[model samples]
Target: MSNQKIYQYLMAFGHFCSDINQTALTALLPFLIAIHHYDYTTAAMLVLVANMVSSVVQPLFGHLADKFNWVWIVPVGLLLAGGGIAATGYTSDFWQLCLAVMISGIGIAMFHPQAAKLVNLASGLHNRGTALSIFAFGGSTGAAMGPILITASIALFGVQGTLTFLLIELLACLMIGRYYRALTELNGGSIKAKQANAQATQQDQWGAFSVLCVVMFGRSIIYYGLNTFLALYWINVLGTTETVGNTMLSIYYTIGAICTLFGGKLADKFGARNVLKCGFAVLFPSIALLAMTGNELFASALLLPMGAAIHIVYSPTVVLGQQYLPNRIGFASGITLGLAISIGGITAPILGKIADIYGLTTALYSVALVPLVGAFLLAKPKD
Candidate 1:
């Protein structure tokens, strides 16, 4: 309805499009392994490459956005992201597919810091948590949809059917491109507001921020560990169909989206520190339960809380990171949203290697141990 709303939604949609490709690569791994006869390590390496590139490079993009307004990155980033997904099925070479996925990762990296900054600019103080949640909710939804999209596309026209989602990305780009002028104007006011806000929060608490980063690192191990291996665990361990395997993955992400959206409001009410503490409390038993169970019903039940616990901290951490280093807002976002998330992906290969040697359940159960470490990191927020 309003200009800011439109811009926020546009940025959110850009996040959706960019992230869909990242998760799609994960969903496609079983199929890739089947067709290429690749080992678990090799299949997971694709996730590693895409995530590694996006994670390592996101802070660079964040600095650029901080120094200069880069609204154009939204549409351009979406195009690169979608184009990479479209090209995936076209390539047979292992290295070529890796390159394509890495292109998608770069697009992901390009979109996030700028989009995050845009959302912050558009939302202002009253609804900061809600706005970040909405932005991240879109991404969680994109990840939820990835398995379904990839599965259907491959089923319909083989792997090349990844082309199916290109039109949607194009539409999103056109919508954003049409209003870049308005977005630029929006940021003019936003920058002034942010500067004032940043000045007010100059009581920087680097010690707490460092602890928070550790908290994020632990969560990533649990979150990405499951994501990288969930589908295969279902298919290989539980002997489910590809559809069934993907449905399980989708369920976790879909629930994750809901929890993250609500988690922000919860964090606002409870304080981010308390919210994170509760989330870590749930993380241990829920994930351990999910890992140990063989029955689909029990697994699904555990997944709901595990998903909720992991994501409940998502928006809170971002908000906290920004609060912790208010003056270096861009770097805070880069480390919190981008680099913290990337940490999980970076370890996906290691998790895959663990799954290779120790079995998927063992690898994932190892993740359950991480939340205890996160719980220990929780402390009183520096008001």
Candidate 2:
């Protein structure tokens, strides 16, 4: 096909790989604990360290993407991440595993912002929302596939075999990157284009941006908590099989991926504020259902919207973030895609501690309260 098409595909695939690594690691942590005799504290710390690296580096990369051309960062970062993840299967010690996680995190940190910048360049204004919806869906799909992939690998090759899976993903990324080389701008010249775009946006939109950030903080906490901890709860408290529990988690991510596009369309048709509020509203019932129910069938049904409610805010909030900082699309993307999400990842350990101490049910109930805080923060009437 065309060079431009190849470039967009490569950029999207890069985003896909970055997301899969994050989700795969989250899925692998508890299993790693089981196989290696590491405790919950260590598992929590591993996730925290990985996420911390991504959170800290993404904003810097965002800034670089705005000021300079850094197209090569995406592929190099993916290769590093792939190598780190593959090596995790070889390490037997706790510290070695942590180092591997740290390496993977650094790789992901480099990939996301640069790849997102490329997607923004590929999509035009009229179709930006739709294009971004597809782009975001790639990440969501990775999140959805992670648990299944990890479980399958563990079943077939045991823990060590998981490394082969990671290696394959990395090789896929390398091939995609090489094939899309035409999209790589050789000169550091995109700064002027970015600047000109920024100049065209209305500067008075900061109020909208601030409100959106608060909403993001709220959505992220619930999403990460559910993604990381729900399987543990299902197995520990509810007495479900590990496979059943993972399937439930998978269902949640699937609904989340679907609703991201729906939420974006709803926002485009109505408004981001209203769509965002509705997303928060969905959380109250979904979280309550998850916390209070013991029935497997009931919990599975409720998980449909539980996932949807948690992620429906994603697309709208993303669009709002871009609108708020039209001049700095890359920076805005880092905030929505990386920084705010990192804030959520950083909190995963604290959430794990709470679950460990207070009981999983109580910890979940406490998380259910997060949307209220988000709602309060977002309740500032539209400007």
Candidate 3:
């Protein structure tokens, strides 16, 4: 295969591996608590620690990717991450489980930044948005697949069967290692060596980049709230069955993936700004409609367009961040992809607290207003 094809395949595989474990890992915690008689709060806390560690540590790896060869980091991280998660099946105590999860999070942290930066490098200005969108779509598909796969595995062989799932990730990692040279060529040569040839450094625009970072931070807060809590809201507030609720979440992610794929192509054909604006414009009414409705079918139907509208903006905005810091594509992807998502993970508890006090409906209603603010803040980037 050509370098570009190999690069795209590696990226898709890496993203798929990173994401498929997320929902499965979290779902495993609840299963442990309910089925194995562990502490609920402890199980929940494991999820928090894993997410926080994964998000915060990704940027450090991104920085390393920028300064070091880092090609070898991806497969190593995947192996460690897969092994850690698989080992969770054998842990009998809470601390053991936490340690296992922390190990997996470390592996995740090591992998994402390097992979994302690699994605950005392989994509040129003309097709950057499309390339990034395809990469993100792969991850979204994996994320959606996680719950279903894990739930099925658990149903058939209990939680211990999760170990078998690790084989998929292991094969992917080996594939990435096998194609390393082609990936390097596709990513515009060695990450550390080639970056010095670019124009001005990213540090030059501290002021504007800071503002953009805040916008990403805000966007993530709303995004994770929806991602993490949607199922709970459906079951607890709207009185849907857990199975039905999970399927809705799956549909949301599936639509998000589909939209991102097209969104990239559109951004390449039109302008990234045009695609971004259109996505946000659609999101406003979608969220409003979601807040006002309670019907199960209606809510499920709303997720399709709502997810599409919300995520279609992702690739374009990521490209915008890189454009703003044209010389520091690695750092830009880290900030937007890694740190922003981390910030969102931090805000999840606050959203949960609000839901506890006010109501899930009210919490979601409030979340609807956040994206509008992001849309407004994002306008200044164009100016």
Per TM-score, the best of the predicted structures is 1
Reference-based TM-score of each model: 0.94, 0.90, 0.87
Could you tell me the lDDT of residue 166 within candidate 1?
Answer: 76
Q: Is candidate 1 or 2 superior in TM-score?
A: 1
Candidate 2: tens digits of C-alpha lDDT, residues 23-68: 7777786678678776555677778887788788878888887787
lDDT of 1 by residue, 239-265 (tens): 898889989999999999889899778
**Tens-place lDDT digits, model 3, residues 255-327:** 8878878877887787666776677667667777877888877888889878887777777766777777666
TM-score of 1: 0.94
Worst 10 residues of 2 by lDDT: 183-192
> Is 2 or 3 the stronger prediction by lDDT?
2
Query: Which pairs of residues collide in candidate 2?
Result: 198-327
Question: Best-fitting candidate, measured by lDDT?
Answer: 1
Error of 1 at 67 (Å): 0.8
- lDDT to native, each model: 0.81, 0.73, 0.70
lDDT of 2 at 186: 23
